[model samples]
Target: MSNDHGDEPHELRVSKIRSGTVIDHVRGGQALNVLAILGIDGSEGEEVSIGMNVPSDRLARKDIVKVEGRELSQDEVDVLSLIAPDATINIVRDYEVVEKHRVERPDIVEGVLSCPNRNCITTGDEPVTSGFEVLEEAVRCSYCGTIVREEIASLIDTA
Candidate 1:
């Protein structure tokens, strides 16, 4: 029994932002993690929209995050790539996308993530930031050589 309306065009599922950035093609079930990466917890009252586990052509299902009046810095983007490698960053102004680009995995990340190793120097009271070298499937701490792969989102250090 075919009721048949599959070919009809669909309207936008999520509202667009007047200015800011839209992170598209995030892997399914990771939108909340992406928000965590962006440091948005609604305390600051940021205008944000999230589409989680939405149907997608590329990933079968994907997540999208839209932030109004905010754009991600290089450090934030680099960290975002750790989880959402296929994500495309779209800068919007006046409800139009001004620039669109994919997140590139950096060779080395610095002063962003906190090393998980408790004994690592960076974790001490010293004025040192963490550094990690990106690996094929994990990130290795430059200080203690600790390797982290699973639940990379949980390892995000927003401090």
Candidate 2:
């Protein structure tokens, strides 16, 4: 609480990342979405921090996610792009960002990355593995064998 009205200073909470990945420029309100999509919740004892609506030159207002002691796998990166497509992945070591990568579309997607169709086999009792083929700019579900056009394929936002 500052007594000065117009010139009051704001407190900023920032933590240091000793190692692992620092995902920046996540779309506003989607950092946790990216985390859930990446299956970080299932990682027992793994430390993770998420910041939403932070200031950024690239995104203006954006979300950021920092994962400690773990590196994102290729599959995880693909999942991230599906949710927060414009995010940047930064690899940090010794408190320095050693590598950076912009999210890119993957050639194909496998397993139950997303529910193919509400009535598809993968969503039924059989628990069949789902697959998809990346078309020019879309991913087609191979189970029901339906093409999930890019525009319509974005409905699978949940983890």
Query: Highest TM-score among the candidates is held by which one?
Result: 1
Q: For model 1, where is the 10-residue window of minimal lDDT? A: 1-10
Q: Point out where model 2 deviates above 4 Å.
A: 1-13, 116-118, 125-127, 133-139, 145-159
On the 0 to 100 scale, the lDDT of residue 63 in model 1 is 96
The C-alpha local distance difference test score for the whole of candidate 2 amounts to: 0.73
**Clash count in backbone of candidate 1:** 0
Instruction: Please give the clash total of every predicted structure, in order.
Output: 0, 0
> What does candidate 1's lDDT look like per residue over 19-119, in tens digits?
99999999999999999988999999999999988988889999999999998999999989999999999999999999999999999899878888899
Error of 2 at 16 (Å): 1.7
Relative to the true structure, how large is the alpha-carbon lDDT of every model? Answer: 0.91, 0.73
TM-score of each: 0.94, 0.73
| Candidate 2, 1-159: lDDT as tens digits | 553456666555458789999888887878767766766665587788888887766788899888888888887787567666788999999989989999887777676366547887877788577767666546677777677654433444444
Find the 10 residues in a row with the least total lDDT in model 2: 150-159
